[model samples]
Target: MDNLPDEILLTIFDYLPPRILWSIISKVCRRWKNVVSHRVITMWDYNKVLKTHKGVVAIFGIRHQTSRQSPRGLAINFHTLNIRELVLCDNFPLGEMFMKSVHSIKTLRHLDVFTLQNLHTGYLPPPEVNSIVLNNNIQPGYLLNLARRKELKALHMYGRSQYYAVNEMSTMIVIQAKHLTHLTLRCPEISDPRWLVFSQCINLLQLQLYACWSVTANGVAHVLQLPKLQVLHITGSRMVRITALMELIPTLSRSIVELNLSASSFSSQHIALLAATLPDLRKMEVWRCDLTAADVLQLASGLTKLEDLDTDVELNSVDLMYLSEHPALKELRCLYEGEIINDELQAQSHIHVRSALTAPFPLRACGEGPSAGVLLHAHAYKPIDGVTLTI
Candidate 1:
C-alpha cells in the first residue's frame, strides 16, 4: 500500500500490535518507515509480555506460530526503529543487548533499569539519555560509570541492599551530575559522609530521601544551602538530628515552599520551629506524628501563605473553628484514625462549613466570565458528611 494516503496507512498500522508494528511492519518500505516513525508509540513491559505464548511470538516477531526458535535466533533491527523510552524489568542481559544494538541512541531520552544483575563490561548507556531510574544492588564502580553519562538531568538510585555503601563514587557522581535537578535516594546504607555528596548538586530543585538513616543534622544543614531547592520531602529517616533541623530552620532559603514530614515523632516545639522557619510555606503535610492542638494553632497563626494543610493531629472544636476562619486556608484535611471528633464538634463544623460554602462571590459582567462555569475550591471535613464549603 505505498499508493495509500498517509492517514489511511496510519489507521491500518494502528490496528496492528505495537510489537509487530515496531519490529516487522515498520521496516516493510520507505513510506511505512516514515509513517511509523511518527505514528508508533513504544512502551515495552518485558516481564508481563514474555510470560505468555503470543507475547513471546510478538516480541521476537516470529513468522510462524509453530517455529521452535528462541528469541535470540531472530536478529531484530533496533537500528532503524524510533524508540522514545526503554524500561528494563530486571533483565540485565536483554538490557545490554538493547543498549549495544540500538543505533538510534540520540533519540532515547528516558531509560529505566531496575535490578541490575551486575556491571558487565562493554554495556554502557548512550550519551543522550536524560532521565534514569536504577533500583539495583550495583557496585560503587558501576554506579560511577553510569554517572559518566553526562546528559543525565534526573537520577534516582535505590542501593540499600548493595554490598558496598556509597562512598567517594557517589560524591564524584553527584559532582558529575551538574544538570541533575531531581534526585531520589532510598539507600539506608548511605552514611553521613555519603549524604554530603548531595550538596554538590547545586542545580537540584527537588530532593526526596526515603529510609536513609545515616543522614545527620550537618548533612541536612549543608543541603539547605542549595538556593534553588523548592520541594523537600523526607520520611522514615531516624538518624536526622531534629536539633540540627530546628537550628537550621532560619537558614533555609525563601525558595523552600513545600515540606512533607512523615513517620517521625514531632512535638509542639518542632511545629513552632517550622512556623518560625517557613512563614511563606504554600503547602505542608504532617502524618503519623505526635502533635497537639497548640501545634496546629501555631501553624495556622504563623503561616499566612498556606493554601493546603493536612495533618493527623488531634484537634478540638475551638482549634477547628479558628482554622476554618483563617484567611489563607483554602483546603484543610484532618485525618484522625486514633480518635473520632465528637458530635458537638462535628455539628459546629457542619454549621460553620455550610456558611463558608454559601459565601457569595463578586459577580462578573455578562460574557466576561468563563464559558462553562466558575470552578470553586470546596472546603471539606471528614466524619461530618453533607458539609461542603466553597469560596
Candidate 2:
C-alpha cells in the first residue's frame, strides 16, 4: 500500500463515487485525506446529496458528515463545492445562505428557483448565470438585483394566470437581461399586456412560448416589431385570431427566419399572406391548420428560402409533385390521421425515406426549429423517411 506512488493512489481513488470517497475513504488515512481535499470537489449540489444520501446511507449503517454549516441554514458544506448550476426552492433562509456562499463560485452558469417569497433587497448579483429560470412566486420588484449580472443571456420562466404579477416579472426579466438572446415561457393563462414585455429586449434573437393561450394578436404583433428577432415559436396557443396574424404578416416578412404555429389553425388565404410577406422564412410549421393543396403549392412556389415545412393539413399527389421539384425545399413533414399517403403519392418515384418525428408530438412546437430525432405521433400516421426527394 505505502509502496505505491502518489499518482497510482490518486488514479485508483478517482473510480470511487464522490460520496463514498468523501465520507468513508477520506477518514481512513492522512495520505488519502490530502489527495481528496484538493482533487475530489468540482461540481456537486449539497441539497441533492442530502436528499439522496440521507436515507440510503442510514440504511447501510454508514455515517455521512458535512464540512461546515451553510449560512442558508442547511448544515452542509456550503463553501467547498464548485457548484456551477443551482436550483433553490421556497426556503428563504436557504436562499440567504446561498447568497453568501455563491460569491466564491465565479464559474456559476445556470440558476433556477422554483419559488421565492420576499426575496431580499440587499442582494447583488453574485456571479453571472447565462441561463436562468424563475417562477411566478417572486415578490414584486425583487428582480432588480438580476440586472447587475451583465453577462446573463438566456432565460426561461413559468407564470400562472395572475395578470399583474406575471406582467411585472416578465417586464423586469426583459429589462434586467440586457444581453439576453434566448427566452422561453410556460404561462398558459398569461394576460395580453404581458406579451409586450419583450419589446425592451433589443438583442433578443429567439423567443419561445408554451401553453400561451391568452396571448392575442396584439402581443404577437408587438413581438414582430423587434428589430433583431429571427426565431419565433408559439405553441399550444389557440387564442391568436387568424385575422390578427393576417394583418401583421407584412411586419414579420423579413426579420423572422424560423416560425412555428403548432396547435393553431388558419385558411389558404392566410398561407398566401405568409408566402408573400415572409420572403426570408427558412423553416415554417403550421400543425393542425385548415390548408388545402393549392395553399401548399403556393407556399412551395412563393417562399424561395424555405428549407423545412411541417403541417397537419393533408397533402395529396399534386402537393408532393410540386414539392419534389422545389429548388430550396429540403424537408417536408405531413401530419395526417387515417392511412399512410407516401406509397400512393410516390409509386413511380425512386426516392423512399422513412424517419420518425418523435412520439406524442410536442406539447408545443419543439423549440427553435425542426430536429431530426423526434418520433412520429400516433395520429401522424407513417411518414416517408427522406425530407426531400429528386425527380
Candidate 3:
C-alpha cells in the first residue's frame, strides 16, 4: 500500500464514503492528504465535516475567523482547489462575505441555492455558470441578470412570493429563451401576457409550470409554438380548459414524448383524445386527475408506446390482471386507499407494480423544491420518466 502511486490511491479512495475518506484515509500520510485535499467533495459532506470539526478553516484551504458575529467570517481561495459545483442550502449562512467568496470560483458551472432573501440588493452568479436552481423569494431583476449570461442552459425557479413585475420577468424570458432548453417556473402571478413571451423560446425541450392560475387557453396556445418541446408538465393551472387543450393537441402531437397533467380534470374523452393525438408518448402521469378503470383500459389499448403509467384511477382485480399482461408497459404506479396488495401481478407478468396511500408523484421532495436531485446534478441533466418512491 505504501508503494502505490497517487493515481491508484485516488481511484481506491473514490469507492469509500466521505466520512471514512476524511476521518481515516487523510490521516494516513502527507501524500494521501494532498490527493484528498483536491478531491471533488459534495457540499453536504463538506458541511458535515465543518460541523464535526468546528473552527477548522485551514482544512480545505479556507481561511476564516471562528467568531459567528464576524462580518468577514469566511474567505475561500479558489486557486487552491478544483471546485466545479456549488450548492447553498437554507441552513448555510448567506452572508455578503460568504457570497463574495463563492463568486470568485471561476470553475463553477452549476449552482443550486434555496430560500434566497433580499435579492433586490444585488446577487450575481459566476459568469461561467450554465445551470441554476433558485428557490423562494427571488426578484425579477436578479433573474434578468442571470438570463443575460450566454452560457445559461437550464433555469428552475420556484416560489410564490416573488414580486409580480410581469414585464421584467417577461423581458428576462425573452432574453434567455433561445438559450434555455430546460425551464421550470412556479409563480401564480405569471399570466397570459407573461406566458406569451415563452413563444420566442423556440428551442425549449422541457417546460414545467405550477400554480399559474391566470394562464388560460390563450397562454397555452403560445407555449405550444415551441417547435422542439418534448416534455410538458402543467400542474395546478386551473384556468387552462380541457377544450383548449383538445384544440391544441395536434400542434404538440409529434414532438411530445412525456406528459404530466396531475392536477387537471380528465374524462374518458380526454384520455381518448390523448391516445388518438399523441401516439409517441412513452411516459404519462395523471395521478390526481379523474380517471376510471375503463379509461385506463382505453389508455393501455390505444397508447401502444406507453412504458410507464402513473394514475389515481381505481382498478379492480380484473383490470389489474389485464394490465399485468400489457405488452409494452414495464412499470405501473397507482393509489390504493386500502391495504397494500401482494406482488402476485408483478410475479406473473414481470411488471413492476407500486402502490401507495397517496400518489407517488415526483413533484417535490420532503423539504426541497421540484426536481431537487436533478438540479443539483444539472451538469449531466437528462429527463427522467418518473422519480420512484419507496413505499
- For each candidate, the alpha-carbon lDDT, in order, equals 0.53, 0.56, 0.60
Write the residue-wise lDDT of candidate 3 on 1-391 in tens digits: 8899888887887665333555567778888877765563333223333332221212221212132423243334332333544444443455667667767766556665543355543566677767766655666577667666665677776433344366766777888877878777765678787787888888888887655567787887887657898888776556767677677666663688888776665557677777877887898867555567788888888888888887656776677778877778887776554543456754677567666334322434311223332332233221121221100
lDDT of 1: 0.53
CA lDDT, candidate 2, residue 14: 58
Off by more than 4 A, model 2 = 1-103, 112-125, 135-151, 158-164, 236-239, 316-322, 336-391
The regions of model 3 sitting more than 4 angstroms off are 1-79, 159-164, 337-340, 356-391
lDDT per residue, candidate 2, 151-266, as tens digits? 66776554331222565557566665567787766556666777767777777787766656777777767777677888877765567777776787778736889987766646
Model 1: number of clashes?
A: 1
TM-score of every prediction relative to native: 0.61, 0.58, 0.73
Steric clashes per prediction? 1, 12, 0
TM-score of 3: 0.73
* Runs off by more than 4 Å, candidate 1: 1-83, 88-93, 101-103, 119-123, 159-164, 240-242, 307-334, 337-391
lDDT of 1 by residue, 163-253 (tens): 4346645755566657778776654577666667778888877776655456666666667767798876665445555666567667776
Best of the candidates, lDDT: 3
